[model samples]
Target: MAEKEEYVKLIGSWASPFSRRVEMALKLKGVPYDYSDEDYLVTKSPLLLQLNPIYKKVPVFVHKGKVLLESHLILEYIDQTWTRNPILPQDPYGKAMARFWAKFVDEQVTLIGFRSLVKSEEIDVAIKEAQELITYLEKEITGKMFFGGETIGFLDIVVGSMIPFCLVRGWEGMGIDMIPKEKFPELNRWIEKIKEIEIVRECIPNREKNIEHMMKIVGRIKAASKTA
Candidate 1:
């Protein structure tokens, strides 16, 4: 464990992929910090509101009272500040490409996957889009062990958080296989290797809990659609 820094707190939710991203960074850096888990479905925390007034989302990393909103920004800050187990590459072009793929994961994969899970009307279309996103990622992934060759990097952290909550939970709870093994053999292998990392194992969202939560969201969406 790293020496405790001056009051580091993260206001996030367990089921939130974005929150999980920051958590993965902190854990990987061996930073000791406090986690304030919020219930997004029920109510919002005052600090979450105060920290992220505009976007109003989880993964608001507060380090020494310097509030950081947005998961990607928090991740960059974590890498620069911690100076240990660096997530982003030091070179200019490597860092740029990493950010590009991370944005794709957020805008394409995460949005499409969540829509598939929570909306009954767009389930099939959304699932198809999610599959296409995974196919694209399979080719983009060039490393043997992770996105950045031997060690986990920024792109890995972004996509890594999605596996347990999105991929694994989607398969187990909804029988939705976004990445088919026969087609996405490389991706499947990458996932297995990323899972082997201790920090990844510890940081991924709870599988069973996320499954139950996703099912509830699907049920509610279905019931509402029937009335509409």
Candidate 2:
């Protein structure tokens, strides 16, 4: 085993894509770190609350006692600090594009995908809107093995993290095919390829378990909507 250099710890939940993203980056970069499993659905850990009082969310990364919240930001920090296996692109333009797509994955894909489930009444409209956004990604990934080109990088990690929940099983569990294989051949192929990666296979939650968890989330969202 390699000698530990600095104190590194990650507060995260196994089922959370955001948490998985950070873990994937760490593993890809060969950075050994301690993991604190914070299953927020059941209870938020006191340590997580203390570290990220504002969001009180999982995937709060701690390096040498310095705390960092937000999965995307933590990914960048890991890439910049580790410097061995670069996650983000080296050139300015490539880095900007990576950041742009990563933001799109979080803000657009995640929101719209969840909205489809929350507004089950407007399922058709939501599915259409989601298809439109996925079209952009389909076009972007044309002839490429990944969003980051040959190797998985910033955009890949950001988008790949959501594939199970946002594009596949989570949606499928709700009887929605967010990314139909016929409609998104390239994207679907990319999904298959990414899933084969050792790090990704290790980090992804079990399909049956994730589906059960997603159903609970959908039920809660529906209940909240009814109250509202």
Candidate 3:
């Protein structure tokens, strides 16, 4: 692509699932870029605010000075622009199916499902809700390497970004284990397979470390809320 002539930059955070998605996409597609870490809560830089005023979130990609927000959108842009190692399926239906699962997991699993932990009522609903989703996955996803077919595709990147988060917090911290070893064998198998991939392995956060990090953050926020 003509865009390679210009520098590519990514503003991301260390433990953010969203940032990991973009990082994995860029790595999979063989897109060379620089990464700048941003602190979302403490201090956000001017460049980050300017690039993503609406959300002011991390995982913003700057291509030749043009800013792109949202991890999913950035991943699609990288896949289309690079054309090196294609992430999406070629077949039309296959592509749609892959995208469906990806979006479903990204929106529900990561955003809504994970947030359920902090609140007492939300925690119960979150567990039940996650189990329902996993049940559907167990039935629908039978064989075929990934959610797509053979190679790891777009869906893999998005879901994989959440895998570590799920394992660390949802499973280890909360003691939920939505994908119990016996019940969701296929999903567990896929998680094991994903770990073998270097890019996936490297980008995922350290599970134990993240649990501690998250606890500290959550505790501080809860304490502050009580005082307020």
Find the candidate with the highest lDDT and give its number: 2
Order of models, best lDDT first: 2, 1, 3
Candidate RMSDs in Å, in order, are: 3.0, 1.8, 2.8
- The best candidate by TM-score is 2
lDDT per residue as tens, model 3, 48-126: 9898999988888988778889887888888888888889887899778877887788776655555554555657777
In candidate 3 the C-alpha lDDT for residue 75 amounts to 83
Per-residue C-alpha lDDT of model 2 across residues 92-200, encoded as one tens digit per residue? 9999999998899889988888888778577899999988999999999999998898998888888888865434666878788888889999998998999899998
- Candidate 3: residue 4 Cα off by (Å): 7.5
Q: Candidate 2: misplaced stretches above 4 Å?
A: 1-5, 165-167
Please report, as a residue range, the 10-residue window in candidate 2 with the lowest summed lDDT. 163-172
Q: Write the per-residue lDDT of candidate 1 for residues 46-116, one digit (tens) a residue.
A: 88888888988788888877888888999999999989888898899989999999898888777677677
**C-alpha TM-scores of all predictions:** 0.88, 0.95, 0.87
State the displacement of the C-alpha of residue 202, model 3, in Å, after optimal TM-score superposition.
Answer: 1.2
How far residue 183's Cα lies from its native spot in candidate 3, in Å, is: 1.1
Screening candidate 2 with a backbone cut-off below 3 angstroms (N, C-alpha, C), the clashing residue pairs are none
Candidate 1 lDDT (Cα, 0 to 1)? 0.81
